[model samples]
Target: MIGEGVAVRIIPCLDVRGGRVVKGVKFRDHVDMGDILERAAAYRDQGADELVFYDITASPEGRSVDVAWVERVAEAIDIPFTVAGGIRDVARARAVLHAGADKISVNSPALARPDLVAELADAFGSQCVVIGIDSIRENGRYRLRANTGDPDNMTDPDLDTRAWVERVQALGAGEIVLNCMDADGVRSGYDIDQLADVRGICDVPLIASGGAGTPEHFLDVFRRADVDGALAATVFHSGQIEIPDLKRWLGEQGVRTRTGSVAS
Candidate 1:
């Protein structure tokens, strides 16, 4: 943030469950907020550079691609969006893209196949692939978390976050959306140590998600590590922080951002 650098994006995340925007902490604090299209339009008008639509219910239900509603939100917003959760294959990825998503984010699918990322990237371009890696702090060290979506939880299926970051990049991942569920909806702050691990291992652009609760939280993440963007749900959705105010604060903190004329 101190020098000339790549623009750090203020990305908004919409964790959609049953056609409603929901806020949950470590995948636990599920709160039905509002309609997806309504929130997407508000953020687009509020100067959000991009949006991420996550089907938070996909995991528990065993289905994916909230295609109908995704299309609606995409049609309502001018900025691009990255859709994730339960996108298991290229065909499904294509369906979401056809629905108006600018990018496809796959977490469990890529890890299960490892080749899925390459296939999707080869099929659609690298920029269209965003791999979500959930990491958490544990036992005085940072570790990659699997399946739980809660950063604090861990299981034997876990892979080393940094090691997999390198592997995913080689597998043709264009960017990594590092999310720490422990910080999700907590409004505390991002996992700096965890973000540092991903930032250190990832060569492509990195997006830091989870733990953003205030305007100062945005500045804190970028200042602590080299990240391409910041993604938040509760704060932005609850009106605890506004995109325009976040950008202004980042600028004051020496972080460069898209200086567009905010529509709101």
Candidate 2:
């Protein structure tokens, strides 16, 4: 059961490609937003509980994350942040952490080798290992897809979504970022039913990503799915929803959230 006093975190996601923040619908047609450091600092001051940075092209291009940018972001923001993309081994994960990232997220590589989760957890403790699962609903069933949900990487026909979540938890993952590919940038609302299903099997903190368009959406996900955090990229990046205001709205509706400036 989720703790009653744990505040629901509001997180901003920055999807970077070639070192610039980008936003797109369902992981296609990405448009550059702005300088990564500028956006990171803006969100931190806006009261975001944490930030998520993903090098959108790293997995597809077959390379590791650029530690240089991670270091810059670490210097720019005082809040905790997670770095993802092409983090496949313990050594690479160590480098990112040493570069000042609070956590490292693994997706495509973890799908190919499940033991990597165990190895990371063993080396850095479960708290530092975050498993990012990009899922799509297919014919009434949720299926796992990787490589940022590219069709070419959708070759795992038998990978069950629920099973994968359960397996990762057993492997010692401390958190799960469930990115609903179908809802990636639509911003209608979160895939509540899907989040609830994943929430059922997830033991660690669950972060809901995709389809967050309004303050109500965040409230719904928290009340319906019992998620520990809500993450958004398009809404936050475009300034459609400000973190401080969103947190204030959630608070007005009786949701527990961190108020005022994020602690340095």
Candidate 3:
């Protein structure tokens, strides 16, 4: 199911802070947009397969995940949602799950212990855990970035991506979210080639984040990256592209997406 014409996913990401739905410009520009409920409801109605809620500044200094906000958003969205921000351990992960999130994305915490992935898998199902990776092309080479990668730890060189994949998989992570920090918002498109390279080495589902400017950008990712899902933040938040329109566009471009509405 991983290819250009497969049932490619069009996922909208909501960057949150202080319990408010905010949109950032390239992982650095922070601006509040509206209440979480409205934006999430909009994405769900727009026909997104799923939505991502990221607490943009959850981990500058080992901060804890925002539980109340997660709970609120989980209660608000109809489609499955992932809450990630300062998820560093099993306890925090459990809290996120209990708050109603279908999935929890892990970053710095996984890098630190590596075993947290397995621990979370044992506690929650493997499907509940997604490993978020931030990659950058330096001197024509893509390397991992340690800060919440892709507007995600949000850190430094942590060995190679291949090694990280092996360890995280052994630890029982169910999916890998390859986010190119370098491509965060140039809007050119996703680093499908980069994600494809990561996919070639990993068996888990790969969610390609960063660098989505247009519907064509999404098509390029699905066609070239062989990813399970494509996540975008700004276009969705800034009102450049609507979710239903994007999904319909994907369908027109020969990408598979569920045909239904929030009210349906």
On TM-score, who's better, 2 or 3? 2
Please provide, for model 3 over 180-214, each residue's C-alpha lDDT reduced to its tens digit, 9 standing for 90 to 100.
Answer: 87688788889877888888888988899998999
Q: Write the per-residue lDDT of candidate 2 for residues 1-264, one digit (tens) a residue.
A: 247588999988888888898876555887889999988888888889999999888887789889999999888778899999999999999999999999999998998899999999999999999999989999899998877635455555368789999999999999999999788778899999999999998989999998999889999999999999999887888788988889898889889988865565
Compared with the true structure, what per-residue lDDT tens digits does model 1 show for residues 1-264? 346756889998888888888877555778888888888888888889999988876743558867998789778778889998888888898999999889999887677679999999999999999998877666665566555543343343466777888999998999999987668657788877788767887889899987887777788789887788988877888788888888877887788987768663
- lDDT (CA) per prediction: 0.81, 0.89, 0.80
In TM-score terms, candidate 3 sits at 0.91
Better by TM-score, candidate 3 or 1? 3
Clashes within 3 Å, all models in order? 0, 0, 9
Which residue runs of candidate 3 sit more than 4 Å off their true CA positions? 1-6, 149-154
Best by lDDT: 2
Error of 3 at 152 (Å): 14
